[model samples]
Target: MSQSRRNFLKAMGAASLTAVGAKNAKATPKNVLSDDRFGVLVDTTVCIGCRQCEYACKVEHDLPAGNIDDYSDRSVFEHMRRPDHTALTVVNGYPSEKDKQQQVTVKVQCMHCDHPACVSACIVGAISKQENGAVIWDESRCIGCRYCMVACPFQIPAFEYHKAIEPKIMKCDLCYETRTSKGQPPACVEACPTEALIFGKRYELIQIAHERIRKNPDRYYDHVFGEHEVGGTSWLYLGSQDFSKLGFPDLGTKPAPGATEPIQHAIFKFFVPPVALYALLGGIMWLGKQNREEEE
Candidate 1:
């Protein structure tokens, strides 16, 4: 209320505004910059669950001969299974009443979600979303905390518990080392003699999926899983029955579990806070120096 008090408050307010303005001057980087590379699109309508793909994955990866249940031999078919620490990919049998014996075999592995949560979960930057959209993990950088497994909405990433010596995060890296990096198709797609698993550009795969549904409406489900669901996966699926009945949950068009980076980006206007802090300190120190000079 007094003149001196009013002037002091006004100066403080003006200083804050200047700092805020300075902070806002920098541009923020966008998090959703997608890559042009493509990936395998599993057309579930065609997979027969021959286990050949699983076999190929085993030989290629070169693990112990056979798993206790299946991973030892990669017999994902021996039991209805999901991809785990040992098995990178598993073909599960889907029995639909609409097309009985359609016996749709869906190959379960990393969907390689476009906006991946695994990448965000890792404190060491061990998990990365590849250019082709395959979400891969680097063991060298991993701490084996298993947060990635927890962060994945699909529960795809698995950890290697077999080794008490030095276990690590274990899951499909989209066969990056063995095939994709060489400009060749993945083992699963290659092993499918029936052309069930098709690997190619993501957009092209969606077109192929729609084509199959249109050709035989009675044989295939009208919807294509992973095309838009969970912000779209590099790998996709099709089936005679609804995806949910076959264990695929009802997911939204939004990016799957590990894709919440946009939310982070919005909150962390990276340079803004630092710049503002600097401006405030600069003004404070400048004022202190001015006061000392006046005293002198």
Candidate 2:
């Protein structure tokens, strides 16, 4: 082959490879972050049903600071309560099978998932996963679509339904702007007297969870709740019994994004191939016309 022809073919091959690489890259789902992101480890056995974490979360968020003493009432645990606009976090009591009189308390809030479904589902880009492992919402960017609430596997996001105007989505932000950004632990973690909640780097917390489980196999179940659920979350949990009994959903290790991305990609790919093919043909036709014009 002529040297020029060989060079032309090589250039075309490189361009085709680059195009394929870009397509494959876009098709792949977002990967898990391996960086030094913050996380929390919750040992359910250590939680003493004090509800101090709930009170601290309220105070930190500047919510109704009703007498802190009122939070001591265990009657609230009679029925399940979730995090709402007024409260960013809630501590719930589950009847302990070992002791019928005693109830195990577990704090509920946004899990700050490594691959957050809320971030993926937000049509207006209202929700985002922070570098420090916080899944946060921007009210200014929100159009009140409420798609995020439907998307979350944990059902963490709560909407301000009472407000007639300018309602905002509410959820735990991992205290990113208030404490975590300033190198401080979350208010709830700080308030836990029993050290039930351990706040640190995600990887470090996972190691600690494993160590605790290994040291006292009888005390805790072998599984670390957030290590692989929905492609891993920043909030880790250790339970003496099955997590499902503690009100945690039994989500398999498969990432939630896997379900949504394929449909979305299929729609995009359906349109993209035709558009790209047209552009390529148009370019070839244009080149041919230019050559003819040159000869004329």
Each candidate: what lDDT? Answer: 0.75, 0.89
- lDDT per residue for candidate 1 within 254-287, as digits (tens), equals 7654355655555557777678889999999999
TM-score of each: 0.72, 0.80
- How many clashes does the backbone of model 1 have? 10
For this target, which candidate reaches the highest TM-score against the unseen true structure? 2
Give per-residue lDDT, candidate 1, residue 217.
88
After superposition, the stretches of candidate 1 with alpha carbons farther than 4 Å from their true spots are: 1-35, 65-79, 257-296
Cα lDDT tens digits for candidate 2, 99-157? 78888888999998887888888877789887778888998999998989999999989
Name the lDDT value of residue 79 in candidate 2. 92
Displacement of residue 143 (Cα, Å) in model 2 is 0.5
